[model samples]
Target: MRTRPTTATAAAAALTATAALLLTGCGGSDSEDSGKDKIAGADTGASASASPSLSSSDDGIERPEVSLPEGDNLIFAPETTGDAKADAVLKDNAEYLRSIDEAIGKQNPKSEAVAFYSKDSAYLGSVEWISGFVKDGVTVTGTVRYFDRKVSFSKDGSAGLVYCADESKGYTKDVKTGKVNVTEASKDSYVLYNDRLRKNDKGVWQTTKSTSDRGSEVCQP
Candidate 1:
């Protein structure tokens, strides 16, 4: 894990870099234009304010429930892919993304749902990512839209997914002061994510690894 900064601005930058490297597998220097609100986290007990939803797989595997903070929202477009296998992959993948936010919302780095939906590098990276939010005393607010999702299966049985995130409407709020750091929409607000997932014996497609590109031309409108 990388060292985190103490200052608010520096902390945000460090967190962004950490996410790109560990969680998203995008190794490089941090972008100056990246917004602090691009990531998600929450105050303690934030999850209690929202209703927890259970995500179940077709194979009768029941995933842990996940809930987000009141103001924080993640929207996924084209909820169903028409194909059964692809839909299953998308469902679990969406849950994986949601579980990360749920962990942040609960301020728990070892969130059950997060562990249930991911493993290996994805799991370790999520823990470190959530820890950054917990230490910063910041929580995400507003909405983050995920769209243009495409999925494919490999010969080895692993699944691949690519998607876009629109974070222009998202903001990071200071948990103590109730201050929201809002930013205008820009190229940096759009992000592209490429992920790999494998179905476990439990019938859950767990995210194994992922890579992201912020301000990628493909993600921009």
Candidate 2:
């Protein structure tokens, strides 16, 4: 099991879990954050114990206190099913990532992913959803990873939905170069305050203002 921090205050697990968000291919490999260069023959299969608290907890990282938001936000519950709309969104995101990998020339593609969302917040693998994941000028063509939907929140659902998305992703140019079997991962698990769903002026379900990001600047080209 790979665990990474939500931020600077959170650093229990290493960056391997989020690697899929940061990857491509066809395996149950987890994704990462930093220290990838040091990973050699790292086994990234599923962990025997699966707990969201443990999964999201990156022990030792500093957890700074922050103020909660006051506004209508979407939250997820335990039995949320997939709809034609949401599934399309998720599939599109997968395609978008393939383009990024092509740009970087990644090899040995593999990933496992999930998505979750609500009227207010959207989650990508237990992380807060944000717009603009990619850096400027990248012209990303698909959506990012979508996590599974959560039906219940222990608290007020201040955070968004939960996800176990495929954040693993990275690449190297030459196959002959000596390298460690390090995985790549990245994600910000938290909350996006005061998110709202907006409709286009024509009254269509335009994706510009969904609580979950359809696209934005979270990643770089």
Candidate 3:
């Protein structure tokens, strides 16, 4: 599910979804401008389906202490559920996926990650996939660590998370062929994200339906 096509009519409309299992190919450039950059409506595909088994016991649950991102190479894996309102709705679901990587690393034309999503959030279809890499100039710089967060709540309010992602030193830079690419790591680069949250009426825990598997051996690293 690695679909890359910043244009040419989004590579001919992603070749008719080529059997549908997309997501994974963020950061794009090289636009021939048929205009359609899509990288979000959330469906990071290719799921061989095998991720429901996490329960190593966090029963005491109180985690929430991971804020690193100022370069230690990003890493977040403190999961919880001692039930402080479901751990503050999973710490606002990891700060709404770190506010969409801080609005695609500050390209911010209007991304506060849409205040934690839920307008039918697949993270708000990544706001036109981060504005087509901020309109082809480039602005997604590195680090997207997250790891092993499993969360699961339901009294019918519904909630779910299945995180793990390394993004191997994440990258994106073609501001005119300075070309960087990077996001490779392998064993399928340890990735998995299966969210579905719900709790909005101002209560917030937003995110609504998301999917991604992209090479998971239970998210290796």
Candidate 4:
């Protein structure tokens, strides 16, 4: 039997890449889906601390607008940050994962999973890989590497997390031999997940999911 242990290491490294992974979104048609998703809603006016107003989403990444729908979803998000939320979320999540990297070894899967999420690894789990997306009047298409991630804002506006697969490169795991083999010829798709939060009650966002990338894919909803 092969005792190659890189799978665990790779998995751990993947946990760190949660921020980079959660950007994937399932494909949708122009008729069914619009350029922007309507904000669910929030009562942040209650706080008097509002996010700065932005002009446009011409920077490449789409700026999700937060507006009070007819009810709750919209109230929570009057405006969306210009990639600020996604960037900050990724950065904070990376920091949190680094802090616990050595702490959460292979021995702890469930605990490590939670640790990863608490650190804000966005949508690092429950992903399906397909390819491409539409953003900001621009259809910046991409070949779905390995999977897709879902993004959402928390109810309190203090937290937001993602659940996506992290298919960084191409490789395979010979479980019978316990070997995580790699090769340039290996381009078949496999899904992984990365969940990250913007803010947590504990003060810092972290990973939320990513048990395994064995089976998951991007879904259209």
Candidate 5:
């Protein structure tokens, strides 16, 4: 029953009704400009070395390994915050984002990485997002740069993270035709996200709730 952020605006129209509804928090409107930057090529296959390392919980619950396919890049700036807890939250958050892409690339609604990184509304929202891509027969490509990431802890021991995503160079690709639908960079190309995370007994920070605003003034360059 909770609402979460949607994906890029470039592909929102193509998504299913259920998916579109579930993904309202992270997308933008089409009235923006159209100037895109060149995207760099990425290596193919899922490699642990290529993705964020898994976080082990105190309960010894084995975390699922997350990986992305070719052309799907997630670049996070300031990989570390010098604070252990903050860094862990950032790393796990990156993993959660990566898991969504991984599920879409694999066309699997039941993704282990996704299940491992999220729970409750966040988890359900992610499944719907991946299902949308699968039903549309499309997958994501190109690079999504996440920067200006900041994390803070609440008195109740929950963590809140805010970050910006530059999705200008990313696009959706047709699975059957292998055609890439690229879009130009505009105000909508950048998104600002606010997420709530809680560390479980296993020592993993799972995203519980999230919200996003595309073309947010704070995220604009």
Candidate 6:
């Protein structure tokens, strides 16, 4: 049976175009039935040190104003667990994933990958894989929305978080020639990611392991 693509490594490759598997952008009009969502609300002017802002989402939630590179539009909505520990894990997880996505979109994987990934071979090795994409001049352009995140803490000071990603608007293109390889949207376009994380001495959550399941029906939520 196929292995990596059946899990998170394949999911990462599909989103970033590193696993040698190309995913066509899943383009469709937004519908409530689709369960596809957009992040809402703006930063509440809380100090940057304030993480896991448990502010209730409302009609006045202003979208954070940040410059997104063209062809890359990833929107991360706020976490609303009201549980500090859970919020901390989710917050760090979102930032870590965003850092990697931005690095790939900007073609600067080296610096970004090193910053989030652990020194362990599995996680760090993924960075090496991503570096190859940068070396090949691949640029990812599209939108991936992450949702339905759940965090479980372990007694060993480690944690695991699972989330679903909708990659309906992302694709890989060649930077030099502006050539793009697009494919028909498949079940694989919808994915679920399981990430294993541990905080280092610096209080930073580092990705120790990750896996993905493509076309996971559970992720549709």
**lDDT for each of the candidates?**
0.67, 0.23, 0.49, 0.30, 0.68, 0.52
lDDT of 4 by residue, 21-85 (tens): 44433321112112122223321111222223322334432221222111111011112346766
Q: Model 1: per-residue lDDT, tens digit, 149-216?
A: 77766666777676778988988777788788888889888876766677776677877665666675
Give lDDT tens digits, candidate 6, residues 1-221.
Answer: 11121223444444333111211222222111111111132111121222222232332332222234566766654475888776767766665665555556566645433354343433454555557668988766677777766666665567666666777666777878987656566677777666666665545566555667677666554
lDDT of 2 at 213: 22
Distance from true location, Cα of 73 in model 1, Å: 1.1
Residues 1-221 of candidate 5 have per-residue lDDT tens digits of 11124433343333222223223444332212111211122111111122244555554656667778677888998689799888999988998999888888899977777777776556766788788888999898888888877776666677767777888888889988989888878988887676667776657787765567666666677
Which residue pairs overlap in candidate 5's backbone? 5-25, 5-26, 6-25, 6-26, 35-185, 57-202
Candidate 3 lDDT score at position 12:
27
> Over 4 Å off in model 2, which ranges?
1-82, 106-162, 166-221
Compose the digit string of candidate 3's lDDT tens values, residues 1-221: 11111112323233223212222222122122111222353322111122222222244322222232233234576556476765765666776666555555556635433443433435445566666776876654566677656565554566655566777676676555555676556665555665556665445566655556555555565
Model 4 has a clash total of 53
Residue 36's lDDT within candidate 1 is 27
User: Relative to the unseen true structure, what is the C-alpha lDDT of residue 165 in candidate 6, on a scale of 0 to 100?
Assistant: 75
Q: Which stretches of candidate 5 lie over 4 Å from their true place?
A: 1-61
TM-score between candidate 5 and the true structure: 0.74
Candidates 1 and 6: which is better by lDDT?
A: 1
Candidate achieving higher lDDT, 1 or 3: 1
